[model samples]
Target: MASSSSSTKTDPSAQGQAATQQRLTEAWVRLAKQLTSSKDYQDIASLVAKTDVLALKNEKLERELQDALTAETRNLNAIQEVKNENMAMEDACRQKESQVEAAQMKESQAQSQLQKAQEEVAVLKQELDSNASKITETVNSKLEKEVQIRRLTEEMEKMAESFRQTEADLKKTNQANMGQLKMAVDATTEELNTLKALATPLKPQADKRIPSLEAIEHDV
Candidate 1:
């Protein structure tokens, strides 16, 4: 009897709990249907779709921005490289200019030295020419002296031959006239003394000696 009494009490409470659960389920179903049919829900759905499109556009923009930044970085690097190359080229140009200047200076010095050498050579040539002229003049003077000596010698030889012939003629005429022979002998002696005076300067060079006045007179 106690068990039957406890069972009858739990059945009414169970029925009440089941009826409350059914009511809560019906309220949830009604709220869900209202939310699906509302304009706000459709607007939210549209907003979600637009947000997705905006996100995709933002992503594409970010990618394009990254590409642009990369390109800018590359351009900046290229510019720096070009600047460095320009600086190197400028340095090289300056070095070349300095080298050219140095070479030009050396060339100028060489030219100056060459000019000095040429001037020295010209002076030396002038000296050599002057010396050669002086030598030629001295040689010509020596030749003229030799010729004069030879002429003097020949004249002396001719005079000596004339004196010998005159002596021979005087010898032949000595028997014809003694007084005329004495006068001729005196005249021949005077002429021979004059010739001896004239030939005194050439005595060192003459191969033949003039006959002495005493010897000529003795021969006469």
Candidate 2:
């Protein structure tokens, strides 16, 4: 019985040992499966990190594109400004040309007026010359008439002086000849009266003309 009981106890202990070994093998398999799952999780995390890096690069490229667009817009605005300045300059040049043309027209008009004035002056000068010649001719004719009148008046005064001298000589001779003095005095009186009447007609000529040489000598 003791042998049988000891063999029974040994067999039960061996069965228990076998059962523990089987349990150990199951736990090891479960641990290996967990390890594989951890490997998969790590792979997924790495893939996510790569995706994030790609996204960051894409954002940086977009920023660069925006900056390029802004720079192009600024350059376009600058070009437009330059175009506006050029157009303004062209307009100013056209205006200056118009002003210069107007000034030239004014100068031409002034020159035309000056030429007309010169022609008018020439015509006036010719008219003045004709008038001056007429005036000179009239003055010369008047002077010649005055000179002729003066010469005639001088001859008349000389004739009156000769008659007076003849009368004086006859009076002196009559005084010297007392015997024939009556007849001589009668004839001399008649001649003296005739000479006086002849000299009396020069009153109008005396008022209208200059004195003769005889008249001046008599007055002196």
Candidate 3:
């Protein structure tokens, strides 16, 4: 009886092993059939290759996008720098225009000053000419007066010399007349003395005959 029981237990174990092996064998058979179809195998290989190619293209597109973004940033910075330079040029231009205007105003003022100076110089020249003419006229008048005085002095000297000559001629004629009158008076005195001497002699003679002569004369 113990031997028969051992045989029955052995039979159950063997049956279980047989079932597990049969299921494994069926799964293997189905896998082998699926692999053996050529169309299915080719379709799987083409699909795998297409997936790899898509992955490579996606990576390249990402790199190009990054480069484009970098270029756009650089362009923006360059545009900002140009705008700053233009603003500086505008400020410089405005400053130059203001300086030019100031210089022009100064030039105009200088021209005006020059014109005023010229007018002053002309006035001074005219005044100087007038003064010179007046001085010349005064000098001429003085010279004429001096000439007239010299002529009058010469005339006075001539008149004085003529008067002296006439006085000398009158004095000589008076001296000659006085000498003639003295000679005539001496002659007259001598004649009177002779007559007196003769009359005295005659008177003595006549005295004797006086009486007779007197008588005769009385009768005559």
Candidate 4:
């Protein structure tokens, strides 16, 4: 009788448990139907679509950022190259300026030397002019002395010719005077001889009367 009473009680408990399980299954089905038909479900669907579009936009923005960084790096390198080229150009300019200064200095020295050479040439020209003037004066003086010597020589020749003529005339006059003196001496000697001959005859007669004349003159 105890075994019969336990079997009857277990069969009632199992039937009640089956009823509870059936109610839980019905509630889960209602909940699932409500969720599928709600506005929240539609909002979740639209949000998922918006998230896909945002992901695509984010990928494009990341690619643009990477390209900008690459361009900036190239610009920085170009700026450095320009700076180096400017420094080299400045060095070349300084060297050119130094070369120009040296050329100017050499030109100044050449001008100074040319000026000195011109001054020396002027001095030499003045000396040459003075020498030419002295030579001209000496030539004129020599010519004047030659003219004077010629005049004196002509006068001496004229004086010598006049003296020769005067000597010839004097010699002729002396010869004529000697001839006349010889003729007069000869005439006087002949007259002296005639007078001596006449005086000899008279001397005898005068001697004979000399004594009588002397007696008569003595008586008187």
TM-score of each: 0.57, 0.46, 0.41, 0.42
Off by over 4 Å in 3: 1-66, 138-220
RMSD of each: 9.2, 15.1, 34.1, 33.2
Per-candidate clashes, comma-separated: 0, 0, 0, 0
lDDT, each prediction: 0.75, 0.66, 0.57, 0.60
Residue pairs in clash, model 1: none
lDDT of 1 by residue, 1-220 (tens): 9988887675788899999999999999998788778999789889999999999999999999999999999999999999999999999999999999999999999999999999999999999999999989877666665565556556655655666576577568664554554465456546555655654554534434445546656765
Clashing pairs in 3: none
What range of 10 consecutive residues in model 4 has the weakest lDDT sum? Answer: 204-213
Please write out the lDDT profile of model 2 over residues 58-79, one tens digit for every residue: 8988898889889889989999
Rate residue 185 of model 1 by lDDT.
49
User: Model 2: residues >4 Å from true position, as ranges?
Assistant: 1-65, 159-220
Q: Which candidate is the best by TM-score?
A: 1
Q: Model 2: number of clashes?
A: 0
**Candidate 4 lDDT tens digits, 104-199:** 898999899999999998998898899889878766655554444344334433433333343345456664553443344345434434443444
